[model samples]
Target chain A: MQTFHFDPVDLPPGIPAFRAEIRAFLAREMPRDYPAEQKANCWTVYDADFSRRLGERGWIGMHWSKTYGGHERSALERYVLMEELLAAGAPVGAHWIGDRQTAPAILRYGSESQKQRHVPRIARGEAFCCIGMSEPNAGSDLASVRTRAERLPDGRWKINGQKIWTTLAHRSHLIIVLARTSPADEKNRHAGLSQFLLEFDTPGLRVQPIVDLVGAKHFNEIFFEDCIVDAECLLGTEGQGWKQVTAELSLERSGPERYLSSIALFFELLRVVGPSPSESVRQAIGRVTAEIWTLRQMSLSVAGQLARGEDPYVEAAIVKDLGNVFEQALPPLVQALADDGIHLEQDSDFVRTLALLLQTSPSFSLRGGTREILRGIIARGLGLR
Target chain B: MSEQRQILADTADRLFADAVTSRRIEGFDAKLWQQTIEMGLPLLLAPEADGGAGGDWDDAGAVLHALGHHGVPIPLAENMIAAQLAADAGLELPSGPVSLATRVEGALQQAGTRFDGKLLGVPWGRHADAILAVVPGHTVLLRRTDATSLRHAHNLADEPRDDLIFDNAPAVCGPASDGTQASHLLALARCAQISGALEAALHKSVEYAQTRKQFGRAIGQFQAVQQQLAQFGAEVAAAMCATRAACRAATRGDASFQIAAAKLRCNLAIGFATSTAHQVHAAIGFTREFDLRQSTQRLWSWRTEGGNDRAWADVLGARVCARGDQFWADLTARDDAVSLT
Candidate 1:
C-alpha cells in the first residue's frame, strides 16, 4: 500500500500582515450587536453585502488568475483569509460555494469565454452558484443518478431531472447540474455522466425549499422539466462529469469549513463557564482544543499538498470524516457539562447561542458528504476494498 | 526537512532497524546499547562545546522518532533528555546512559554536594550510569553506585523501571533549573516517541489485515475492520502532526501549551491505536511472539512515562480557562497564544 503523507505546513512569511488586514477589516465591518443565533448559523447566514465588501478587499477568488479578476495570491494566503473569517463567524455563505469550488471549476474546465463570463462576476461577489449532485435515490451512490440531458436538434441541451439537498438553490444565479449523457454501460457505470451550467432564470426549472430538522430554510429541492441550456454551458468535455464532479467534491471537503462549524459554541462555552471551572469542564475543553489543533494541522497539510498540485484525496477524506466526528460530539458534551444546578438567564447571549448550536449540530455530518461514504473512500485508499 | 536532519533520521532508522528485533526487546542486550551510544545517539541534543552533536530539539526529535518506530529497547530517549539537562546545568556529560527525575515520592535533601531521596518509576533506572534529578533548588547528577538499594520493576513493554533509594549519596550538583519547565520538556520528548510508535502500530495492523485470510477472503475486506483501520489512521495522523508542532515549539524555547496539548493528544492516540491494533490482530496480537505487541506495549508504557493525558490535560485546561475572554483572540492570533509561554 502507498503511504499517506501529512507533512507539517507553515503559513507564508507575510501571513501575519494579511491576517492583521483581515482582522482590522472584520472589526470595522461586522455588526456591533449581531444576533447570538446568527453566529451559530454563520455558514448558512447569507449576506451579499458582507461578501461584496470582502470581494472589494480582493479576498474572494484570491488563488485564481488576475485576468479573471482574481488577486493572484497563493493558496496559503487564501487559507489565512478563510480561517480568520470562520474564526470570527463571518457571513460569507452568499459567495462561499462560487469562490470556493465553482470559480475554480470554471477556471479549470470551462472555455475561455466561460471563464471571462462567470469567474469575474464570482470574484466580485455579484454571482452565486449551487451544486446539483444528489437526487431522490442517489444520495450516497452518486453514479446511480438518473438525470438525463439530451442533445437537441438546434445544438442546445434539454434537461429533465430532480436534484435534492441543493443548498441555497433559490438564491443562486447558476446551478452546476450532473446528468446522464448516454446510456450507462454495465462494465463502467461512471462513464456516461456529464455536467452542465444552468442559469436559474431558465423556464421550467423550479426550486422549493427543504426546511431542515431545525426550523431553517437552507436546503432546497430543484425540479427540472424540459429545462434548456445553450451549447456553451457544458463544462469540460462531454461524458467526463463524474471525474469533474469528484474533483469539485474534493475542493468542497478539504477546507477550514469542515471543522470550524462548531467553534462559535466553544467560544460561548468559555464565556459561560468563566474562570476556574470544574475539572470535568476543563478536561472537556482541553480535549476539544487539542482535537481542533490536530485537525487544523491535518487540513493545512492537505492544503499544502494541494498547492503543490498533489491529489491528496484520501487524506482529505480522512480529514472530513474525522472533522465530522469532532463537530458532532461537541453539543452533547457541552450540554452535559452545563446541566448542573446553576441557572443561566434565559436571555443571556451564552444560553441563546448554545441553544442554537445544539439545534443545528446534527447537520454537520450530512452536508458535504455523509460519514459512511467518506469512510468508504478512505478504505479504498487504504487498499482494503 | 534539512539535509542534515534527513541524514540523521536515516542513520538512526538503519541502525535501530537491525539492532531492534522481536528477539532483542524480549530481553535487554547491553551490547546493542553500547553500539547505539557509539553512534553518538545520546549526545544528539548536547552542545558542540561539550563534545556532542549540538543539534536542536527538532533534530534530536527526528532521531528519537525513528528509534521509537523500531521499538528500540534502550534508554535512548531518556539519555537524550538527561544530556540536555546536564548541559543546561553546566556539568560534564556522563559516559553512560542517564535517567532523569524531577519528582520523587520521598523527600530529597541536599547538604554540601550530597543528596538523599527515594526516586520512583525511573525508566531503566537499574542500568542507568547516572540519575539527573532537578530538585527544588539545584540540579544534581548521582552515580548508580551511590544508590543504597534498588527495587526493580517493569512497564507493559518489559523495559526496566526501577526505584532507587539514595541515602547521603555524593552528587555533582549545579545551578538551579526550572523544574516545572523541565517536566514539560520531558513531556514533549515523550510525545515525539509516542507519535512514532503509533505510526508503526498502524502500519503493522494495516499489513496484517490485508494478509490474514478469513472466510475465504482478506479480513480487511470486511467493513467493520476497514472502519476501525480508518479511525486508527486518523489517530496516527493527528499524533504525528501535533508532535511536529510541539518539537518546533521546543526549538523556540516556548513550549508551555504546545507541549501540554501535544502530550495529551498523543496519549489519546496511543489509547485508540493500541486497543484497535489488538482487536484487528485478534488473539495473535496478545502474544509476545508477534511484533505487534512490541509496538503496542511500548505505546501503553510510554503514554504514562512523562505525564499521561489527565495530568497534561489539567495543565492545558487551567491555562485556557485563565485566559478568559482572551482565549478567542489568543487562539486565532497564533503569535499571541504561543508567546504566552
Candidate 2:
C-alpha cells in the first residue's frame, strides 16, 4: 500500500519575518474598498502594478537565485509569502503564472540564451505567462491534444491549433504551448508531444474572451493559425510534453491557493454571523476551518517535499482533491447556516460575497483538474489503475 | 524525523507489534499493559527526576501514535497525560496505570487536599491505580482504591470507561502549573492517537482492497473502491497534519484554537476513515474476529473520549467569532499568542 507522505513541516525561522513583511506590504498596497466578493476572486485579480510592486520588493521570485534577478530565499519563505498574500486576498494573478511556473520551467529546461532572455524579466515581473495546455477536446485527457507543431525547413516550427480555457492568455506575454510534434503512437498516446514557449504576440495567434459564471473575463480561447516559432522556443526535448506538463501540474496543484480560494468569503461569513452563533453555524464554520487547516498543512508538507527535490505528485494530487472538496463545500454550508434569505447587494458585503461564492465555487473542483481526473491520478498513485 | 525521534518510534513500533495484538487485547491481557509500562511509555512525557523518560510532546505523540497504530487496548495515552500532569504539578508520580479526566459529569470539588465527586467516563478507571483530575486552581490526584465505588463500562472498542465516585477522598493536590486546560491536553493526546489509528485504518483498508477480489479483479482496481480509499487517505493525512500541528502548539503550552480545530478535524476524520475502511472490507471489517474492528472501534470510541467534535467545534467557532475581524491574524498568530480564549 502506497500511503500519502504528508509529513509535518515546521516553518523555518525566516517564515515569521517573511509573513510579517508580506502582510505589511499587503496592508499598505491592497485596495481597501473592494467588494467582499472581490476578495473571493483574489487569485484571478490581474493587477500588473501590484505584481510589479511585489517584484520590486523581490517577493515574486524569492526562491530563485540572485543571478537570475531573484533574491535567493528559501522555498519555505516563498510559501509564507504566498499564504499571507492569499489570506489577505491580495491581487497576484498578473505575474503569478510566470513566477510560479514559467521561470522554473525555463531554468530547468530552457537554453542558456533562453534562460538569460526570459528568467530575469520574469523575476522582475516585467513579463506575464499563461498555460497553453487545455484545448476544446483535451481538457483532462491531455494526451489527446491534437495541436500540431510541424518542423519547418527554416529550422523553425509552424503551429496550428486552438487552445481553450487559456487563463490570462489575452494579457500574458508568453504562452507555453503543448503541441503534437509527431504522429501519435497507438499504444502510447503520451509520446510525440512537445512543449514550446511561444510569444503571445506571434503572427496568426488570436485570443478571444470567455466570460465565466461570475461574468468575469478571466479565461479565453487562443487560436494559433500557422504561428511560427524559432527552434529555440522548444522547452524540453521533443515528445516529452507529457512528462514536462505532468511535472508542471504539480507546481500548479499543491499550494495554499488550492484551499484558500473561498477564505475571504469565510471571513465575511464570520463577520456576518456575528459574535453569537447557533450550534449548527458554529459547527459549520468549525468544519470548514478544520478542513482548510488540514489542507494547508498537507500543502505545506508537499511544499517541503518540493523543496527537498522530491516529486510528490500523488501527495500533491491528494491535497488538491481534498482542498477542492472543502473549498467547494464552504459556500453551500455557509448559505445553509446563514439562512437569512438576504438579497445580494453591495450594501451587504456578506450577502453579496455569499451569493458570488455560491455561484462560482462549483468551479473550484472543475478548474484545477476535475474531481474525476484528480482521483484518477490518485488511483494511479495507489497502483489501482 | 530526527534521529532520536526515529529511534523512539522504531522501538515503540516493535514493542507495540510484539506485545500488543488482537488476541492479547481481546483477552484483556494485563501482561501487555505491564510490558508497556515497563517499557517506560506511561512516563514518556514526565520529567526524568520523577522516574520518567523526560521526553517532549512530540516524542510522547510518537509513542501514542505507535500504540494507536497497533491498536493497543490499554489507556496508555491517559496514563501519559496523568504522569505529565502529576510531574508538572510537582507531585509524586505513582506506579501502575493511571487515567486523567477533564469532563466529569459530577463536580470534583476541591478543599485543601481533598476531593469529592463522580468522575464519568474515566478511561481504564477500573484498572488504573489513580485518577488525576484538574479542578479549580489545583490538579487533584486521587487513588482508585479511595473511590467509594466504580461502575464499570465499555466503549465501542470494549475498553474500560468506568464511572467512579469519590466521597471526600484525600489526594495529593498541587497548584496547576501546566497552564493548558485538561480538555486541551486530552484533546491533543487523542488527536495524535486518532491520527495513528486513522493511518492504520487506511493502511489496512488499502491492503485488504488490493487482495480482496471481486467479480473479475481486486476490488481496489475498481474506480469506486479506489476513490473511496483515496478519500480515506485524504482524511488520514488531514488528521495526521492537524494533530501534529496541534501537538506542536500543545508542546509549547499554547492551547490555541488549533487544539479545538484539530480535535474536531480528527474526530471528523475518524468518521470517514472508519466508514470507508469498513466499506472497503465489507463483511470482514464488521466482525470482531478480524483485526479491522480494533482500529475502527477505537476510532469511534476515542473521538468522543476527549471532547467530541461538536464540543470542540463550539470552542473553536466561538473563539474565532470572538476574535471577529482578527480571525486571520489569530489563525496565523505565533505560538506565544495562542492562549485559549
Candidate 3:
C-alpha cells in the first residue's frame, strides 16, 4: 500500500489549480438556462447534453490514461474533480456510474481491444452506462440474482430475465449487468454468477423507469427478454463475475459521493434557519457535523488506501454504512431546523433542492446494498460474524 | 510518534480485558493495579529520575484509550489524573487513587449534607497504600492501613461508591489545588474513558445490527435502525477524535481549550452513543447477558462521573468567550501545538 503523504481529503496543489480550470470551463459551458439546482451536491438533476459536455471536455474520465482519452491524473486529482463536480451539483448524473466506475472497471479488467472500443467515447460522455446488480428479488442479496445469460451457437450470449432498481436506465446508452450463468450449488450462493456489458438498443432489451418513493423516474426495471451480446462484452470470465462486480461495488461505495450528496442541503438548512440556533438545533447540528467530519476522514483514509492500489473492501463498506446514516439524518435535521414555516419548494432553488433531498433521503440506506448487508461485511471484518 | 505507547496500550488492553470481564475488578484489582504501577503509568508525569514514567500526554492517552476500550472496571483514569496533579504540585506520585484531595466540607455544601466524602468510587482506594485527601487549604496523604478508613455503599453498576470519613485522621498534609484544576483534569480523564466505552459499544451495536435480521433482512437494513447505527458511528468516531486529542494535550502538560472541546465532544458522543446502542438493540442490549451492557453501563456512569454535558459545555463556552477577548492572531495562532493534530 502506498503510504499517504498527507490526508487524502486535502486536494493537492496540482488539483486546486485544476479545480480553477474546471470552474472556468463550467462557468462558460454550463448553459445560462442550466437547471442551477442540478449543481447542488447529489441533487444534480439529469441533463443528457450537459453530461455530454463534460465528456467532451475530458472531465468525465479524469483519472483514465491519456491513451484511453483519460487525463492519467493521480487519484488525488480525481478526488478534487469529483468533489468539485458533486459540490457544484453538475448534471453529470446521466453518465456518473459509467464514467466514475464502469469505465474504471473496463480499464482495469477489460481486454485491450475492449478498452480501445469504449474508453474514448466514455471520456467524451457520449456513451453512458447503468449498473444492473439489483434485481426485483435480489436487491440486497446480490448472489440471488436470477437474470440469466446463456452462451448461444454463434458465441454470443442470450440474456433473459429482468433487472430492477437500475438507476437512470432510460437515458444511458449501455448497461453493465450481473447475471447468473449457472445453477445454485451447495457452495456459496455467490458462485456461478457472471457479468455482461449490453447495449441499451439491443434487440430484446427494454427499459422501464422505476419511480422511487419520491416519485422520481431516476431508477428503472430493465427487462431482458432475449438481450444478446457478443462474447467480447462479458465483463470478466464466466463465474468470475462475482469478484469483478465486487471490485466494482467497492469503487461505487467508497467515493466522496456518499456523504457530499447532502452537504448542499445541509448548508441550505443552516441558511434558511437563522444565525443563532436553538439548543436542540445546535446540539443536533454539532453532532451531525462531528459525524460527517469523522466519516470524511474514514472515507479519505480508504481513498488513500485505494490510491496505493489497495482494495479497501472493508473500509468501503464502513464508509457506506456510516454515510447512509449521515444522509438519512439530513432530511429530518433539515426539517427540524426549518420547522418554522419553511417549505420544500418555496419558490427558491435552495428550497427545491431540500424538497428533492427529503424525497430522496429515505433511499440513502437502501440503495447500494442495505444497511444489514453492509453491517454483515463490517461484522466479518471485525471477526464478529 | 513513539512505539512505546503502542506497547503500553496493547499491554493494558489485554490485562484490562482479562480483569474486567473476569469480574476481578471489584472497584479495583490489586495485582493488576500493581502491574500498571510497575509499568510506571501512574508516574507518567513525573521526571525520569523521580521513579516516574516521564511520558507525555500522548503516552497517557494511549493508556486511557486502552482502559476505555476494554471497559476496565477500575477508575484507572481517575487515579492517573490524580497522579498527574500531585506530581505537578512538586510531590512524588503516591501509590494509588486520590479522592482528588479536595475538601470534604465544600463538597458536602455542594452535596447538601451528603458529604462524608471518603474516597468511595475510588479505584484502588480499596487497595491503595495511602489516600490523598485535601483539607481547607492542605493536601494530606494518609495510610490506608492506619484504620483511618471507613466504608460506604456500592454504586449502580456495583463499583463500591461508598464514603470515607477522614475526621482529621493522622496523615501527612500538603497543599490543596487553588481552584478548579482538579475538577478540570478529572473531567478530561472521564471524557477519555467514556470515548473508549463508546467505541466498544458502537462496535457491539454494529455487530448486532448486521447479524440480527428480521422480515428476511438484518434489522440494520431498516432506515430507522440504520440511522441509529450511523448516528452512533459518527458519535463514536467524533468522541474518539476528541478524547484522544484531549489526552494528548493533558499529557503535554498544556491543558488548553482543545481539551475542553474534547471533553465536550466526548460527553455528548458518549451520552448519545450509549443511549442509542440500547435503543437500537432494544431488549438484547438491555440484558446483562451481552457485552453491550458492559460498555454502555460504564458510559452511563462515566457521564456523571468526571462531568456531564452541561459542565463540559460550560467549560467550552468559557473557553470560546476567552478567545473572543484575545487578539485575533493569538486566538488563531498557527502552530499552536496544543491544537489537535
Candidate 4:
C-alpha cells in the first residue's frame, strides 16, 4: 500500500488556459480608467459588463445544468475556473454568489418555473442573488429566524422581517429569503418556514448598507415590510426551508476556494523574496506550505466525496474547519513575511494586497460559521461529545 | 496501514491485556516472549533467509503502534533492530540479549592486539547468546559467556536492558567490515519505534478526550482539550512524516542525515505524547496498574538511548547545513524523500 496519504492535487486541467483567457479578456475589454487601488482590490468590485461577458463565455453558471444556460461543467471544473479567477483578481464579484452558491441551490430545489426564470438570466449575468438567512435576532442561530410570511386575503404571502448581514443585497437583483409560514407549528419549528425568490425592488423592500470595519460596503440589513409575493416565487417546497438552508450552507462552506484565496499572495511572496531567508522565516514558509498542501488534499478528498453524490456533511465540516484556519492564518503570515522588509505598504501593490487580505482574513472564521461552532460539529460527529 | 494494522493491533491487544501484567514485567515473561517469537515477531529483522518476514520500517512501526496501543511489554523494536545493526555491520549478532557497542573518538582504550571495550545500555544484552560491541577498529562479537561483567541496568519497561562490560571480546564474528559499522542504523530503527508510540499515544488521547466526559460534555468538546489533542495529533503526525521519510532514504541507501532527523523528530514526539496522554488520562493514569504507564514509561527511557535529542539535533544541524554542496545535494535529495503512507 502507498504510505503517503497526501496526493498533491493539480489545479485541474484547462486552469492555465482559463487563466490566460481571463487575463486576455480583462486586458482587452476592461476599462483602463479602473482605479489602481480598485484593480488591486480584486473581485470585490462589481462590474456588470465584465460579469456579463464572463457569462457570455458560459463561465457564470458553469456548474449548473446546460439546459438552464449553464456550461454543464463538473464542480471541480467550475472550481478551477473560479479559483484561478479569484487568485488573479478577476472581476467575478458581480456573479460570484449567484454562480457559486445561490444558483446551485435554486437548481436543486427551486420550482421548474423558478429555474427557467432565474437560471437563464443568472447564466446571462442579468441577475444576481444574495442569501437572506441571518436576521436581526439570529446570527449563528439560523433556526431562530422570525421572518414571518403570512398568507393574505389577496392570496399573496406578505413577508415582514428584517435580515442583517445580507451580503450584496443592495446590488443583487434577487434575494432568497427563508420566512416562517407558521410559527404555531409545534410539530416542527423549522418545518413551517419556507424559502422565496424575492425581487430586490419589491414594494416596502428596503436595504441599508452596513459598512464593515474596513470601510467596504460589503454587507447590508434588509427590511421586508408587508412585501407581498405570488406563491410562484416560493422555492422548493414549503416547510423544508431549514433543511434546504442547511444544504445551501454546505455549498457555501466546502471548496479549495476557502484556502486558495491566499495562493496569489503565496506566489507573490515566493517570487519577490526567495533565497537566504532567515531560519525562522524558512521554517515558517516550509511549515505553512506543507499545511497548505495537507489542507488541499483533505479538501480534495471531500470534493471527491461530493462528486460521488455523497452528502459528506461531516467530512465537509472537517475540511472547512481546518481550511478556515489556513485562510485565517494567511494574512498574519503574509504580514510576518512582509515585516522582514518585503515592503507591504499601501502604495506597493504587494502591500495593498496584503492590507486587503489582512483586513479580510479575520472574517474567514466569521463567514462560514464561527470556528467554535464548526469544532462543535466535528466533535459531535466524531462522537467526542 | 490502518486496516491491516487495526486487526493486528486489536488481536495482540486482547492477548497482551491478558498476559504481561506489571508482575510479568519485573520477572522474565518468558512465555509471552516465546509466544511473540512463535508469532514471528522477533524474526522481524531476521530477513526471509533467516526465518524472518523481512519486514521493513513500516511493518515494524505498525507492530510498535499496536504494542504501544495496548502497552504491550516486549522489546519489539530493540530486539529486531539490534540484530539488524550487527548483521549490517557484518558481524554475527548474538541472539537473545546482545548490545551494540558505540565507538567514541579521542577516548582512552587499553591498547592491545585484542580489541577490549565496555558496552552500556545494551538492549536485551543480559539474555543474549552473543553481543556485538564496537572497539576502535572492529565490531568485536562477544559470546555472552565470554563477557566479563553484564549487569542488568533496570529499565522502565520491564524488559531486560543491560550494560555489557567486555574484556577481550572476539573480533568480526560475521562478514561485514568494521569501518562500515555505525549507530545511525540503530537510531533510525529506534526512531521508528518512538514514532509508533507517539501515534498510539495520540490515538489514545483522542479516544479518551472523546468519550471521557466532564461537566456534561466530552473533554474533547472543550476547546482547550480539543486544542491539546489537536496539537498532539499534529506533532505525532509530523514525527511519523519525518520517520517515514527517513525510511525511504534508508531504502534507497541514503541513510546518513535522515537518521538524525527521524530520531530528532521522534524524540520531540515521544516527549510530547508521553506527557499529553497522561493529561488526557488524568488521575487514573497514575496507577502503574493502568496500561498507560507501560507506553509512557518506555517513551521516557527510549529518549535516553541511541543518543538523546541534543546529540541527534547537533548531528542533524551539521548535515543539513552542508547539503547545499552539489554532489551532496544530489546524494541527499533522496534522503528527504520518504514514503509517507
Best by DockQ: 1
- What fnat does each of the candidate structures reach? 0.48, 0.50, 0.01, 0.03
Q: Candidate 2, residues A185-272: lDDT per residue as tens digits?
A: 9899999999999887789899999998778898999998989889999998988889998878888887788888988888888887
| Sort by lDDT, top down from the best | 1, 2, 3, 4
Off by over 4 Å in 1: A1-3, A342-345, B105-112, B335-341
TM-scores for the candidates: 0.96, 0.95, 0.73, 0.68
lDDT tens string, model 3, B1-341? 35777687778778778776667454656667667777776666566776666776667776776787777555566566666556655556555554453324423232222223355455445555655554455444556665345575554556655455654345554466554666667677767677677877877777777789889987776766765565566566556655554555465555655555666667667667877888868887777677777687777777777656655555444333334323212322311332334
Query: Per-residue lDDT for B188-227 in model 1, tens only?
Result: 8878788778888988998999999999998998999998
Off by over 4 Å in 4: A1-66, A69-96, A120-127, A153-155, A184-189, A199-201, A333-346, B1-68, B71-341
Model 4: lDDT of residue B122: 66
Which of the numbered candidates is closest to the native, going by highest TM-score? 1
Per-prediction tally of clashes: 0, 0, 12, 12
Deviation in Å, model 1, residue A352 alpha carbon: 2.8
- lDDT of candidate 1 vs native? 0.83
Instruction: Considering the two chains of model 3, state its CAPRI-style docking category.
Output: incorrect
Model 2: residues >4 Å from true position, as ranges? A345-347, B20-22, B105-111, B177-180, B335-341
